[model samples]
Target: MEKLKPKLFSVMESYNGQQFIKDVTAGIIVAIIALPLSIALAIASGVSPERGLYTAIIAGFLVSFFGGSRVQIGGPTAAFVVIVYGIIQTHGFDGLVIATIMAGIILIAMGFLRFGSLIKFIPYTITTGFTGGIAVGIVAGQIKEFLGLDMGAVPSGFIEKIKIYSESLHTIDLSALLIGAISLGILIFWPKITDKIPGSLIAIIVSVLLVKSLNLQIDTIGSVYGEISASLPSFHIPEADFKTILQLIQPAFTIAILAGIESLLSCVVSDGMIGGKHRSNMELIGQGIGNVFSGLFGGIPATGAIARTAANVKNGGRTPIAGIIHAITLLLILLVLMPLAALIPLSVLAAVLMMVAYNMSGWRQFVELLKTSPKSDIIVLVATFLLTVFFDLVIAIEVGVVLSSFLFMKRMSEVTEVNGWKYVEDLTDEDYINDIENIKYKKVPQNAMVYEISGPMFFAAAHKFIDITVEGKVKKNVLIIRMRSVPSMDVTALRSIQKIHKTCKKQGITLLFAHVQNQPMSVMKKAGFDQLIGLNNFLPHTDDALARAEQLKCS
Candidate 1:
């Protein structure tokens, strides 16, 4: 009873006091912001507007209580629209439910396995690429309404979609385009004009009012979607087969990855604002549970909403109370105010989606990376971007990861190369090269050249050190390999050195090592490399090895 009493007290803490009122007000404002977005995203995902509300109400509340970050509002977001639409088009809503549920299970398992930290390994190029890609996809999906095309259904495949839109260009409805253009303009400029109110919602209201007062023959939710029921969600069980589950696995995995990335990114942002560290694994577990319940309740995909989360913080949200209130407010609106949304113009929704697409694109960062980043980074960025835009996001991510790794290995191999120069750096002239020789060694004598190698001597970079070992290149009879900089070695490099030694023996040349770092020394010693070279040939520093090399040259 004593333990339970304290827990009860903690729940009541956010409910009472002057802070409660502020929380309630902030939550209501956030709820208003979430209202149209939830429906817009749900519609974009090829589901009912009610599914978005259900997601905002159920998953939104549960995530608040169990999530790791403060002020993070969970609901259906623009990110999942493309995948959901594809899944629904291919497998129907039941398939979407199964995939969402399966994805939730995967998320929970990831949390229990403590894999939240692994999300950091997902390259930024891939994230940004797919994000911008999805944004474009969402905007593309909304084009029918944006341009008021008399199309029954939009195609899913990118090329086919473009072809359909291009062919349907003549069937444009001028009213829808005008409304959408005006709404998009308002969304873009409303913030600059005023920050006190939500621009998207305002645009929706104005667009709805304009059509209503002018009596324009514009299509609305009432005409197209009919009435939306506002109530609590009922649970549903999808009948799923192995083939369906298997087919869904790729998309399910995509959703899990996106959820993991977006949620944690939101957590990180909230942490920066509040100066707090969140329990990443716990948060993943919460997200999994939330998604599981959300799918069962006829909801679209849900994740942490960064905009609403930031709004919460800006509005004095400190704990989960604000998040809970946000959910509660959504519930009230769904129950009491949903039917009224029937007046909202589809064009306005499309305009909102366009603004969303525009906001999600980190164009400045993309341009900056192209300009300042290295060749490898730029390649990954551009490749990921093009693949995402032109092909499947799943393929883009998989290929992007593989490409990034290969590029990294190539760079490592380049960094491992050790070479010599003819003219030694006169310490006086070293200033001309800006003292790059400190991290590097300068030119030395032709015959007893001591090449120093540093960095990871793995197979990738290890092959480059052998340029000095090639036939007819060495001017020295006794060459010393100073491995003071090498931190490790692999079997490939070890075997390559053996082949180098055989070639050296053929040409009657000797090789030695000075201050061979402990790690590489142990590896070479274990590999019996020292036995082949003669144990006495290995010295502790450059001076001793150089003396022996000079002595051999003299002889």
Candidate 2:
């Protein structure tokens, strides 16, 4: 319960009027930046533009009020576009809503289970790969609008989309194309002019004015998706059955995992900027609560948006109040200014998404990984990217994780080694000994040999131990096995140890154990390996194990 407490309460304790002013100012600015983006992302996600505002106002508010991070602004993000679009296309609006709610539940469970920190286990290569793939998908999805092509419906399949775009290339609307190009140009260069306002907002305003004043034949939001709804969202539950729940389980899990990863990543970035540590579990819970309400309010899945969070931090936001205010600002816009959004050209929104796709691509990191990372890492990176682009994010992540685990095991197996220790004379030097008692330790007895095992003794590396200690080792009157550096072992490794003991018994040679760590000792005792090897043979120190080995040699 202590870990689940929101950062808002703590920050409010020391909150001052000056900070409140700063928070309000920053919140308003971030809301301005979030407005056009929310619309663009919603359209991209195959939803009504108002639903995006609903998520921004509703989820954004809930996440801030209950979240762990002080400055993180929550809402719909580019990362969810592909997955959300696919869910809607396959399962319908109700299915999407149900899945989102389920995902929210899953996220809450994750937080309560303290699995938030485990999100970092997702490899960097996999994240970069999927992110770049998503960027490509976003860009492809926008081609029709960006070019103003004569297409009724765009296919979601990556290859099919390309084919459709190719067939429709001849039907490009010149007016829409010009508007899109100008919008993109402004988005790219507007930052040089001013930083007070967002480039996307400026681009949309300019494009809408140009299209409306010139009476150009172009597709505006109102022309395509109909009039923007100005009414507040009402709560409703999505219909779900056992069959639907079963069918949606996979997609819901995917959404939950993605939400957790993205939110935590955003929190981490914000933490670096503000020098504050966020409770990861609490953030997950906040995201869960936010998503549940977002779905109930007819909005899509939502998470922490890095760009919005960074904007919050840069604009003097140091607490959750800024996020809460940002949501209020969006709600006010939804009530008053939503009608103007209908006049904005779809092509301009598409242009805004194009810029978003470009920023989120992470192509620089991809290129760098390919150039510098190992072959195995590159393989995972490229494979995940291709799978995400050509197939699905779920498949990409599943395969990427399995492939990375196998590669990691292989590397671990390669590093784990068992070999005879021939440095006894080096240890016997007077200079290396601290006392006369230590210097008088017994040397290796005749026909007795000492072997050391290094690295974790897991299933993959167990074969190395078997190969080196059981099969390839020289015959001896007594054998001393040292495991000082070995931190842990699995059942397979324990079986391998048992095999070594059995082989020594068969050969009529004594087997001794030394410097066993606590975990391995527990495993050995549990598996009855200690009794089989004899309790006297288990020594706490290498010197004692060597003395026991010599005693066995004499016997």
Candidate 3:
């Protein structure tokens, strides 16, 4: 019950009129910034502009009200542009709504299962690769609008779309191009003038007025997608069958994972900015609920938008009230200003998204990784990037995770080793080794041998232990296998141990065990390895094992 508590509740304990004033100012500013972005992202995602506003109004409010982060702002983000567009192309609008709802259910399950902490296990290289890839995709998707190319419906395939754009290069509208260039320039330089207002909003306004007042023959949202809807979204469930549900499961899972990753990343960044801690599980739950409502309200998938969250933080917003206000601001605009939005040039929206692509691309980080990261890391990064751009995100992520896991295992295997204790001279603990050597000279009986196993004995490194202990040149009347440095073992290692015991018995050698850790001991006990090797043969230390060997030799 305590875990279900929202951060909003805690902030309200110290909340006051001063904080309310700050939050209101910040919320209104962020809402202005979010307006153009929401519409642009939705247009890029192959949906009507108002759906974006609906998501911002619904998902944004719900997430902030129930979220674990103090300053997170939830809405549709650039990361989902490619996936959402692809889903819409293949499955239609109803499919997308169903997929989003399914993704919401999955997110809720992830939170309840406490899988939030596991997000860190996703490698940085993979995230960077896919992010840059999505940037490329966004930029590619916007080219048709940005250039005002005379083409009917761009193909979803990356290469095919590029070819079509090239073919339509001769049909570019000069007026549209001029407006787009100006919009992009304003977006880039507007911050230099002032940060109080957003460049994107200004760009939309200027472009709309310029095209309309001048009577320029250019495509606007109304010209391309018909009139904009001002009414609030009605509640509805997408029609889905068993087969449709099964078909959507893969994509829904992808959405759930991406949403979880992006939202949590936003929360972590905001926490750092404000020196606060966020409840990861609660954040996931909030995102889940938000997405569910967003889907039901005919909105696209939504998550915590990092840029908007940062905006909220920079403007002195420290409570969920700011986020709630942002949603209300958008709602007010939807009701009052939506008609004006229809006249805004589509090229201007494209310019705004192109800017979004450049910001989120992290191209600088990509180049730095290529230059400085290890060969394996570079391979994963480059492979994931290429796969994401040339293919789809689903395949890229799947292959990237597997490739990283295998590379990790290979590196770990190289560090594990099995060798004779005589090599202990190489250890930095010379004093301990000298003491053991002196004791061995007096206490160790003749024809006794000791071997040490170091590091984890998993499948990849299990053979090293077998080769050193069972197939090595060392022969003795009694052998002591020391496992003090070994932390854990798997079934493969246990089988190898069994083989060594059999070989020692066949060769007329007495085998003893020493200093086994709790995990390995438990496995050995469960496998009956302890009884097979004999209880008397197991000792707490190498010295005790040596004493037991001497006793066995005498007996």
Q: Which structure is stronger by TM-score: 1 or 2?
A: 2
Clashes of 2: 0
What tens digits encode model 2's per-residue C-alpha lDDT throughout 80-108?
89898888889998999999999999999
Instruction: Rate residue 549 of model 2 by lDDT.
Output: 72
Worst 10 residues of 2 by lDDT: 433-442
The local lDDT score (0 to 100) that residue 8 gets in candidate 1 is 17
The number of residue pairs in model 1 that clash at the backbone is: 2
In the range 231-341, model 3's lDDT, one tens digit per residue, is: 989999988999999999999999999999999999999999999988888889899999999999999999999999999999999999999999999999999999888
Instruction: List the pairs of residues colliding in candidate 1.
Output: 413-461, 454-485
Model 3 stretches astray by more than 4 angstroms:
423-445, 470-475, 553-555
lDDT of 1 by residue, 1-555 (tens): 011111112445656667777777778888888888888998888888888999988888877877766667889888888888888999899989998988898988988888888989988877777777777787788899999998678977777788899999999999999999999989988999976688989999899889988887878988988977877789898888888899999988988888888989998999899887677887787788789999998887788988888888878776677888999989888888889988999999988987887787777778888889888888888887777667767788888899999988887877775754342533456553775335344434446656667777888875577676533354566666777778888888888778778877887778888777887888898999999899998988765776676678755
Query: Candidate 3 lDDT (Cα, whole model)?
Result: 0.90
What TM-score, over all chains together, does every model reach?
0.84, 0.96, 0.94
Pairs of colliding residues, candidate 3: none
lDDT of 2 at 382: 99
